[model samples]
Target: MDIKLSNKNLGLTPSVTLSIDAKAKEMKAKGINVIGFGVGEPDFNTPDNIRLKAINAIENKNLGYTPASGLPELKEVICKKLKKDNNLDYEKENIIVSNGAKHSLYNVFQAICNPGDEVIIPTPYWVSYPELVKMADATPVYIECSEENSFKMDTEVLKESITKNTKAIILNSPSNPTGSVYTKNELEEIAEIAVENNILVVSDEIYEKLIYDNFEHVSIASLNDEIKDLTIVVNGMSKAYAMTGWRIGYTASNKSIAKVMSNIQSHSTSNPNTIAQYASIEGIQGSQQFIEEMRLSFDERRKYMVDRINNIEGLSCIVPKGAFYIMMNITEFIGKEIKGKLIMNSVDFSELLLEKANVAIVPGKAFGSDNFMRISYANSMENIKEGLTRIEAFLQEKTE
Candidate 1:
């Protein structure tokens, strides 16, 4: 007997980031020295205090399942965090903690999207947004963000993308793949559009605490109460607290939306891990000294990668304001042949890099842009230096 899968998932491609990261790990396990820029997670250890809390919970054996919407105490604290850090007030009823920020986004799309509804996702976006939209049976409309514009969406372009079927739009600041931070002024304009168009704005702010230099992260929901009602703010402990494995993320939205998401999550995963949720409470409320130190270290790596990538032949990148990624432009090397392997696109470029240089990186095609590739700078300084060196050498050897 033959089993055919559902058509909805037939077109879904595996995540290129995870694919490359896993390959690198596999290669490393086989004794290969692979430097991978494919993983988007922080490479640091989870903060000691937060880990200690997890240990305490485990020791106490309080691992009972949490509420489908998450622990009441955690929701209350998340509300305070919103008001304190994001300048947005949300009650416990407006919050729903899910497995991760990714899950929160999936719920946001599922809660709002109907069949054939259009969700405007800007590119080069995080690789998962369009797929998640598709998974929700919604159409993902793309708006290309250019290097000239610092990889941010133009208000005019956004206006053009919205049509009658446009039900929602995604806004990611300290954005993945580009490290572009949306300014408050820019958000005000987008908020105006969203409010005028009655579009639900799903704002992903997972990298809010990983900023560098003087960049201030502005929550689009904080622009005004009107936009706040239409916005679902997604965040988690992953990036800021080096807690990727913790799998705790949350969404703050209107009560109705939160309720729908909670109901959906209730039947699916039931609740996020009980211990991780408890640990996240401490991750947010505990001392934030770890954030600054992580930021400084990331800033150092960011500076080094930007300067080094720019100096290398056939590669250039815009300096990112926040997040741990750099979108390295590989346009000049697109059609070159390296070791008789033709470089047709970013995927080809990445494959050759991985095979020849023993370095793993996700192709930008996975992120809705093919002229570039993303490099995560969350690796150690030594790894960053060696990885760039390997990339430079790999590209340098390209011939006709």
Candidate 2:
């Protein structure tokens, strides 16, 4: 019998960030000393208070399923968080909690996209954005944002991309690979276009708390009532609370969209983890000292990485205003020979670095740009120091 897999998933590319991290872990298991700057998750453990709350729930209360949307208390806390942080007022009816921010994104696409609908995604985007759009049966239109522009979408380019078939546009602040935070002024411009075109804006603010250099994270939805109605804000505890494994993310939108997402999640995953939902309540309402400390640590690491990468002979990167990642420019080394390997693209550079220097990183090709590689400063100070040192030595071995 000949069995075939679904055509929908066949074209999906695996996550290069996770793939590199996994390979580094495997090498470490085999006694190889590999330094990884691949995964974007914080290296810090979940805060003591939040973990204690989970323990208390597990020991005292019955850990079971929650409402398809979320716990009422948790949803209330999320609304309060939105009001406090983003200056956006939302009621419980406007929220839908999912397994992770990625899940929230999936639901947003599925909720709005029909066949042939176009979602405008900026280049050097999160690796999963285009794939998620494709999975929703939508076409992902790209606008290549250059490094000189800080990798942000241009309002004029955005205007030209819109069409009758345009359904939505994704806006990621403190963006994943580039760490570019959208300013309030820039958001207002995009919000104007979105409002005029009646295009939905899926504003992803997962790195809102990880900002550095006094850069403020502006939610496009919070700019005005018109854009707010056309926006779905996605956020979660994974980045800020070091709760990646807990699998909790949420979306805030209009009631009609929220209801549709809630219904879809009801039959699909039922609910996010019950215990996690309860713990997230404490995470939101508890003291915020941990978040401050984590942000300071990430800022320090980010500074060190930017300076160190720039000092290295063949590598340089722009100073990221937010998030823990730096898009290291390797264009200077392209078409050159390094340690007997011809560096043709980001993938070639990354593979050779991993094999020669034992330092793992994600190629920019994964993010629709092939001239750079993404390095996360989420690793320890010692590991980052050692990894960059190794990289410096490896690049110094260039043959031409």
Candidate 3:
């Protein structure tokens, strides 16, 4: 029997990160030792204080459906945190909470994008952006950023990508797949371009609290009022708070935009989990000492992993300024034979690494870069050391 699937269902691709993670889990179940560097999640448990808050909420019978935009108290806390940390002012009415950062982003697209609209996305972006744009019935236009520019999209390229049909541009800092964070000057230039063109900017700052080495994250909307009116700031507690499983995220924007997002949420998931919202109030309002500790650990691992990969033959990596992933360029290994198997691109190279070294990493092709692969340093220091050592040995053996 043949089943007909709708175009919307047919066009979607399974998440590449999940696919690699599933393979790693299968290998582990078969009793093979596998070190997974493919997942984008943090390795730490959710903090004790936050967990206690959630437990208290359960005891208080806080499990019912809250407001679709979020609990009022939680929204107020979020607004206050925004003012204190990012120097941005917002009222509770300007915020809309969702299941996670991903949900907030998708809802934003659904609320704003009309069919046939174009969305400008910088390449080596988060894997879900282009697909989400497609799901919204919009086209995704890619602007390639080279390694010479630290993998950041220049203002000139952004300006050129805009057309009468372009509705929005998606920006991710402390970017996934590549850990490139934009500088204040670069952000100002991009904001200027967006203002000139009257295009919307959807800034994903989920990794906002993970910056290291004296680098500061300046919100693009905070540059000026005009930019603020045109930008939607998407953030969550996943990375910084190590609460990925809790799935609490929010967006702050112009009142009209927030209202529309809330309406969309009202029909769709109707509110995020009530306990998660209660816990998120604690997350945003609590002390950030845990975030700093995690950031320092990630910084050390980032430096160590980049140095180790660069020391291996036929592999090279640029030191990332923020975030916990290293995008390693493996162009030198393309077209080589690995154990009689043809290695042609990042995908082939990743499979060879898994088979030969028992190390799992995501291919850059998943993120729209062909000659590179992403290695996440969210594992323990010992695991990172062992994985890279195996990678180094695998390369050396192949070369010999």
> All predictions: root-mean-square deviation over Cα?
1.0, 1.0, 1.0
lDDT per residue, candidate 2, 1-400, as tens digits? Answer: 8889989889998999889889889989999999998988999999999999999999987487889999999999999999999999999999999999999999999999999999999999999999999999999999999999999998899999999999999999989999999999999999999999999999999999999888888888988899999999999999999999999999999999999999999999999999999899999999999999999999999999999999998788999998889999999989988887788999999989888899999999999899999999999999999999999988776644
- TM, every model: 0.98, 0.99, 0.98
| Angstrom error at residue 211, model 2 | 1.0
Lowest-sum lDDT 10-residue window in model 3: 391-400
Off by over 4 Å in 3: 1-3
Clashes of each: 0, 0, 0
Residue pairs in clash, model 2: none
- Model 3, 1-400: lDDT tens digits are 8888788869888888889889999999999999999989889888888999999999999899899989999999998988988999999999999999999999889988998899999989889999889888899999998877888998887888889999999989989878999999999999988898899999999998888778889899999999999999999989999999999999999999999999999998999999999998888888778888888899889989988888888889887877789899998888889777788888898888888789999999999998999999999999999999998888878756
The alpha-carbon deviation from the true structure for residue 262 of candidate 2, after best TM-score superposition, in angstroms, is 0.6
Q: lDDT score of model 2?
A: 0.93
Error of 3 at 135 (Å): 0.7
